[model samples]
Target: MTTIQVGLYFLLGAYILFSIFFCTLVLFSTFADSVFIRYLSSTHLGKPVVYHLQQVVEWLEGPKCGICLAQYWSTGDMAPRVMNCGHTYCGSCIEIFAEQKDGMVICPFCTRTHFCNTIHPLPFFSENHLLIILCSSLITVNLWKCQTCRKKYSSQDVSRTPRVYSTCGHTSCEACVESDFTQKKRVVCLTCEGRSGGITVVAENWKPHVPINYAIRDLLKE
Candidate 1:
């Protein structure tokens, strides 16, 4: 083809590809945003625990404050705000529990500080409640999120503590990383790369699984 024709064809192809990509991006963005709004717009947690007693089966009959064991019967309408530890307390009481006497919110009973302050959806649901909501939402609606990988779950659940963590926030279960990759296949913690500290696969069991936890302790001992 002549140079002008070739250039025209290339331009047409580029325009078609660009239009397709733009349309796809717009649709995906709308769907994602709609889902997020619906998730947050929900008052699922505020729906008054019709099955609150189901949570602490033993405490069902004796629904008492998880922090002080103060009976719910003692406190009026200000219902118990349950923490993930399978414990419950008066909302105001837990507010006290979540307060910062020295600018730090520490759990009075378990001493798990600022645990309630993290951004999981608990303005209404606890861990158990969120699990129930997620399952039910999946059945009725197209709600989707992975707790470990999703941003919402991290803010809402505070997350599972990793066996290995990086400064950039890359984390993994020690056993998981150890078993997955082959030798010389570097699994750099995505967040911790170029930062300073992170778990490097020093050895493996199939080839000498030396967990970094052990390595750190040894280095300290040395």
Candidate 2:
């Protein structure tokens, strides 16, 4: 064989070996990150931060409903529902389990048993609003953007704090509301106006009057 052919063969072998090494390194790094995140998730001190790191953990470990092993989403039957034991599962799985067990909810993870009213089984298992919001935020593009300014709301920016209008269920940032208040203009929900063909005016002092949406606030913290 020619020396050129031998050299080319040697280079190909080197390339394959390099590729294998790089892939292995990436796999190991991802595994380590997953382990670290799991450890953090287990600790009480890390509980607060877990919500923020939840997406990273989910990406590394693949988020799933503990009961049915289905991916969590924002709405419908597959939405996250929290049991009395504090473990979350898909709403469909919970409903099925409750039905089969005669309104008895046995948390698959913690093995805690809870009983719902046999007549109405759903009220016992509350919707995991925080997780639902998180899932929705993950799937939707610019879900937290201010309606007026088109700027994304940030937890760090107090001025950009998101507030939901009670009248229309539309969200606007504090900056936009403040701008309206400064000009003594009625703060209107444009989304509601466009949809309902009428102006929906939010209160002049909206911050104090509007109820805080804990779910959205927690999602923003993430």
Candidate 2 per-residue C-alpha lDDT over 131-212 given as tens digits, one digit per residue, 9 for 90 to 100? 5655655443225576589888766688777655434344567777667656755655444542532243446564543334
lDDT of 2 at 130: 42
Off by over 4 Å in 1: 1-61, 73-77, 84-86, 100-103, 115-222
Scored by lDDT, the top model is: 2
In candidate 2, position 115 carries an lDDT of 82
- Give the count of colliding residue pairs in each prediction: 8, 0
CA lDDT of each candidate?
0.37, 0.60
lDDT of 1: 0.37
lDDT of 1 at 187: 50
